[model samples]
Target: MSHYAVFGHPVSHSLSPRIHAEFGRQTGIALDYTAIEATPAGFAQALDAFAAAGGKGANVTLPLKEAAFALCSVTSERARRAGAVNTLTRNDGQWHGDNTDGIGLVRDLTARLGLDLRGRRTLLLGAGGSARGVAPALLDAGVSELVIANRTPERADALVDLLGEPGRAHSRYWNDLVNEGDFALIVNATSASRDGLQEFSLPFALAASRTLAVDLNYGEAAIPFLAWAQAAGCRDRVDGLGMLVEQAAAAFELWHGVRPDTAGVYATLRGKDASLVTAD
Candidate 1:
């Protein structure tokens, strides 16, 4: 059986093993998937040891995605654009990196939710790896304009500069967002939600017309954001669970050359009602 695993710190809560097991069973592929807790200082060593042991592929998560990007001998264009990588594959004695977070978000919003992003104003909150991974995909999906807001304005500016002029993307200070008019879509890409921070205030007018509010943090972390959106009168709210499953499917395809049926797997995983599970 081929071996695969997800690497991250505090990986005990990861549901990746179960998700991949379901995928393998459904596709009739024999494989073993597990989660390995790896600290930033030892991530490269752990990856090397995994590859040395004939590991086929690996999914990387928080505090290490950037490290994975640095360790890769080569990377996909999307991963390069995002400045981080979440999936790694062993090929020709080298590890290649790729980012599936963007595609996952796009698939969930466009394919699953049946929402059109073409020419819509978007507000992206946060300036971390999650924000970087999904920004390009949103731009590519034809969002009219994207305003990246962060607590540290410089980071937002840096991200906008990194993305270039691909599709009308810009930066804004977090507090200044209230005066910048409403957005058709608002995405919470911050770890603040995961830390149980108090709800941030946003203009009630922001959700004027079918605004979709999505939080990149899932389970317990997602509750605060979803509740805030609901209280703010934005009915279309979704957690990151769907994005997680979709990204895993993308990673599986990259490694196995076959995309598993994500809908069934996603529904099954979401039904478990677990708290603080890590998908990416």
Candidate 2:
């Protein structure tokens, strides 16, 4: 069987193996997928070894996304725009990279959640790789204004510069989001949620009763942020679980030349215990 895996610093919690196995079963594509924990220092060696061992493709997560992008001999336009790579495929003696994070998020929000993003004002929390991968997609989805805020304002500004559409997307300091304006959609693209951050501390003023607050983290990692949104009276809240399945399907299509049905796979995973989950 062809081999594949997901690379990340703390990957033991990944649901990717399960997701890919379901995709293989659905599409009748035989493959082996696993999760490998790799710190920043060991990522390159592990990836090189995987490629040398005939691994066809792999999913790159967390701190390794940007590193994977750096190592790619060729990258899709989306990956170039994202400045990160969440999916890696072995091409003709080289690594080809692509980022499906933004597309996955948009599909989950618009198609699965029945939320229309067109003309919606959006607030994105965190300017890290996770935020970088999805910001362009959110802008492309017709969000009226996409504000990228981070603890370090300079990083957010740098991202806006890279995005280069000041009229549509810009940066705001984290402290200024409350005074800036209310948003129809708020996305948490930070690692803070995974760190068990209890107090999101975002201004309730920035959310209307109908505001959709989404954490780009699922399971236990998502609880505190979702609870904060709920306490702030934002009735619409979502975690990143749907995005995980959707993105996996995209990668499966890339590797297998067939798109697996994701609804059943998503439902199957959601029915399991929350403690056994991971998404990136």
Candidate 3:
């Protein structure tokens, strides 16, 4: 059987195994997908073992994406731009890194949610890896302008500098967000959502006009931000579940050369309600 898994420190909580299993069943592919918990110090050893055992691909998450990028012999342009890799494919005795987070987000928004991002103004909260991973894709998808904001102003400025184009992308302090008016889309990529921090305040006007408020952290991490978005009267509030499944699908495609149907798998995984799955 072809083997695959997701690598993360706290990976036991991931629903990837269930999601991919459903995709495999639906697509008539035989595979084993599971979650592997690897601490920062142990990731290299774990990866080596998996590769030696003939693992075809792996999905990486959290604090290890950058490490995965460094470990790969080759990396996709998107991964290079983001400085991180969430997907890895083993081929010809070498590992290749790719960043599918942005593509996943775009697919969920444009394909699933039917949101039109073209020529739309967007506000991206947080300037960390999550924000950086998705910013370039959003711009490429035709977002008229993107304003990246963070609690620490310098981080946001640094991302802007890294992106290197003032015409479309800009950086601003979190406090300045209130005066920037409404945006068509608002994406919360901050760890604040995951940490259950409620100290961050957003502009009421912006919140009200945002067609979608997307929290990159799903399940428990999404609660605080979703609550805020609901209270702020946003039209649609979504978590990262869709993005997770889509990115995994992208990784599977890179390895198997087949794009598995994700809609059914996404709905099935969402219905399980366990957040994590185990082999029976």
Tell me, by TM-score, which candidate is best.
2
Q: Which residue runs of candidate 1 sit more than 4 Å off their true CA positions?
A: 274-279
Highest lDDT, which number? Answer: 2
lDDT of each: 0.86, 0.88, 0.82
Query: By descending TM-score, how would the candidates be arranged?
Result: 2, 1, 3
Candidate 2 lDDT over residue span 74-177, tens digit each: 99999998888999999998999999899999998998888999988999998887898899999999999998999999989988998889898888988877
lDDT of 3 by residue, 186-276 (tens): 8888887445575446767786735688888777677777787887888788888888888778877887779999988778767777553
Error of 1 at 40 (Å): 1.8
Model 2 scores what on Cα lDDT?
0.88
Give the alpha carbon lDDT tens digit for every residue of 126-234 in model 1.
8878898999999999989999999999989988988997459899888777788788889998877545576756666666547889998788878777787887777
Clash number for candidate 3 = 0
In candidate 1, where is summed lDDT lowest over 10 consecutive residues? 271-280
